[model samples]
Target: MPRAALPPVLGCDFSSSPSRRKPVVVAWGQLDAEAGTVALQGFHSFASLAQWQEFLQQQPAWVGGFDLPFALPRELVSQLGWPSDWQACMQHYASMARSEIRTLFKAFCDARPAGGKFAHRATDGPAGSSPSMKWVNPPVAWMLHAGLPRLQDVGADFPGLLRRESARVALEAYPGMLARELIGRRSYKSDDRQRQTPERAQARAELLDALQQGQHRLGLRLLADTAQLQTMAADASGDHLDAAICMLQAGWALAQHAAGHPLYGLPPGIDPLEGWIVTAPLSRP
Candidate 1:
C-alpha cells in the first residue's frame, strides 16, 4: 500500500499570559524528510489564549509541536502527593492560581539543596528543558498551567498519555534542543532590546542558514520564501524561529510514526506523568 498522506504540522511559541505585545506565535509547515526539506507555510499569532484555543478547535486534523511542558516532574508529583495519573494531576494543577503554584513550588525548592533545588522529569535532563516546576525565569510551570488545559479541551491526544480518535495530535517540543544541535548553545534572539545584540542576531542568521541548507542531524532543510525568512530573522524575540524549530521536531516525529515507532519518536516507556520531548536523541541517558 502507498504511504498515507501526512497531516500538516505546526510549531508553537506559546506565552502563559498572552497579550497584544506578547502573543503566541505558531508556524505551520510541511516536512518531507526523504526530499530533505520542510516548507514554511505561514504563521498565526494569537493575542489571547482564547484566540489560540479557537484556532485549535477550528483547524483540520494536524500533528503539531508545542513549546511547553505537557506534564510535570514525576518526582514533584510523588513528593507533593498530587495525582499520579496525568489527567488527574493536571486537574489538580490547573485548579491553583499562579500565586499558589509559586508558593508550593518554592517551598519544594527551599527544602532541597541549591544545586538540586528543583524536582525534574528524566526527559528534562536529556532534552535540556527547564524543570516543569520552574515558576520564574521562563516560568515553564505557568506554561503547562496555561497550555495543557487548552490541549486537553481540544480533545487532542498526546501519544504517551492518550490514544483516542482525534483530529489533533500534540507533542512536547523544545526548540532550544534543536538550536543547540545547530548552534551549540549560543545565544540567538532576545526579548530585551539591550540583550538583543549584534552577536545574538548573527547567531540567528547562522542558524537559519544551517537549517535552510539541511546542515543538522535531522537531515531536513527549511525552505521559506524570502519574506517569511526575513520575518523570522527580523523578529528579535526569536518567536518565529522557535516555532519553526518546533515544527521541525513535529515533522521528525511524524516521520518516526510513519516508520512504525509507536511513541511517535518519543522514548519508549516515557513516564505518562512526565511526557517526553520530541526529536531528542535516544542516546542521551
Candidate 2:
C-alpha cells in the first residue's frame, strides 16, 4: 500500500494547572521526510485545558508528541483494581477526583518499602522519567490526569493504546529521553528566575547548536530561523526547548512510519496498559 502523506506535527509541553503565567506550550511544525528536516512553524500557549482541548478537536489531521505520560503502571492499575486495558483504564482514571487518586496512590506507596515506594512502567527506566503515579515533585501524574483525557475526548489515535486512525496520531514523547542522548545530565532550564543562570542558558545554546548541526543520531535536522532559535534558547522555563525536542521525535516517528515501521518504532511487545515513550532506547529483557 502507498504511504499516506505526512501531516503536520506537534510537540506539547503540558501543564496540569494551565494559567496565563504557566500555560501549556505547543510547538507546531511540519516534517519533510524526503529531506529529513523538521521545520518549526511556531509555538502556541494555552492558558487553560479547555483551550488546549478545543485546539486538538479543531485540528483535522496531525501527529503529535506530547510530553505527558499516556498511561499508568500496569502494576499500580492492577493493584488498584482498575481495568488492565489501556482505554478502559484511562476512562476510569479520568473520572476520579485528584484527592481520591492521591489517597489511593499514597496508600499503595505507604505499604511498600522506602527504597522502592513507587511502581514504575517499563518506559520509565529507558526514558529516565518519574513514575506516572508520582503526584508530587514534577507532578507527572497530574499531567497525565490532565492531558490524556483531552486526547481521548478528541478521539486522537494513540498506537498501542488504540487502533491507528489516519486522522490524528498521538505518541507519548519525553524530551529528556532525547536531551539526555545529546547532553547527559546537564541542567538546561529552570522555572525559578533565581535558578535560571548563565550555565543553563549555555546548555540550551549547545543543545540548539547540536540539533541544527544534526548531531543527534536520529538523522533529523531542525529548521528554525535565527529569531526562533533565540526565543527557544532564551526561555528560562525550558518549555519551548522541550516542545522543539518533541517535534523532532514526532518527525522521527513520522519517518519511521513512512519507512514501513507501522507502529512508529515502538517495540512489538509494548505493554498495552502502559504505553511506551517514542524514541526511547529499548532495553532487552
Candidate 3:
C-alpha cells in the first residue's frame, strides 16, 4: 500500500515573551519526501503573542514543528492534582496565573533533594530538553504555558494532546536533538554578542554543511540559497538556525507519516499527558 503525500511544514522558534528584541521566529518550507530534500522558503518573526496567534490562524493546512514543550511531566501534573487528560490539563494550566504556576513549581522543587529536584517528562531525556516545569534558565515551562494554548485556541491538531485536525497539525520539536547529533556539544550560536565568536560561527557553518550533505541517518538534505544561508549564519541569537533545524524535523515527521508511521514516529502507548518529541531516538515507535 502507498502512503499519502507530504504537506507544507513550518518550524517555529518560540519565546515566552516575544518582543522586537527577541521575536518568535517561524521558518516556512516544503519537503520532498521522494527526494529526501527540504527547502527553506523564508521566515516570519512576530514580536507579540497576539500577532503570532493571528498568523497561525490565517495559515491553514500545514504541519508545524514548534520548538517548545507541548506538555508537562506526568509526575508533576499528578502531584499538582491537575487533570490527567491532555486537553483538560492544558485548559486547567492555561487558566492559572503565571505567579501561581511559579510558586507551585518552586515549592515542588524546594521540597525535593537538590540533585533530583525537577520532575521530568519522558521526552526530556531523549530530547535533551530542560524539564518543562523549570521556571528559569531556559524556562521551557513558561514556553509551554505561553505557546500551547495558542495551538489549542487555533484548533491545531497535536497527536495525543488534541484531536487530529485535518488541516493543521502541530508537533513538539527540539533543535538541540538534531544539533547534538551533528556537532556533539560544540557551541553554535549564542544570544550574547560577546559569546558569538568565530568558533560558534564556524560551528554553525559546519552544521549547515552536514545537513546539506545528508550526513544524518535521516538522509534529508537541506536546501537554501546563498543569501538565505548568510542570513541564517549571521544571526547571533541562533534563532534562525534553530528554526531551520525544526523545519527539518517537521519534514522528517512528514516523511515518517508518509512511510506509514502515522504518529510521526512517536511511540505507541506514550503517555497522553506528556506528548512526545519528534525524531527523538527514545521516541521511536
Stretches of candidate 2 exceeding 4 Å from the true structure: 1-4, 164-166
True-structure lDDT of candidate 1: 0.89
Q: Model 1 segments beyond 4 Å from truth? A: 283-285
lDDT of 1 by residue, 45-86 (tens): 999999999998898788899999999888889989999999
Compose the digit string of candidate 2's lDDT tens values, residues 56-138.
89999888999999999989998999998888899899999999999999999999999999999998988898899999989
In order of appearance, the predictions have TM-scores of: 0.97, 0.96, 0.96
Clashing pairs in 2: none
Give per-model CA RMSD.
1.3, 1.7, 2.0
Q: Pairing residues by index, what is the TM-score of model 1?
A: 0.97
Per-residue lDDT of model 3, residues 204-241, tens digit only:
99998998887997788999999889988889788999
lDDT score for residue 58 of model 1: 90
Q: Rate the local accuracy (lDDT) of all candidates.
A: 0.89, 0.90, 0.89
Model 3 segments more than 4 A misplaced = 1-5, 283-285
State which candidate has the highest lDDT.
2
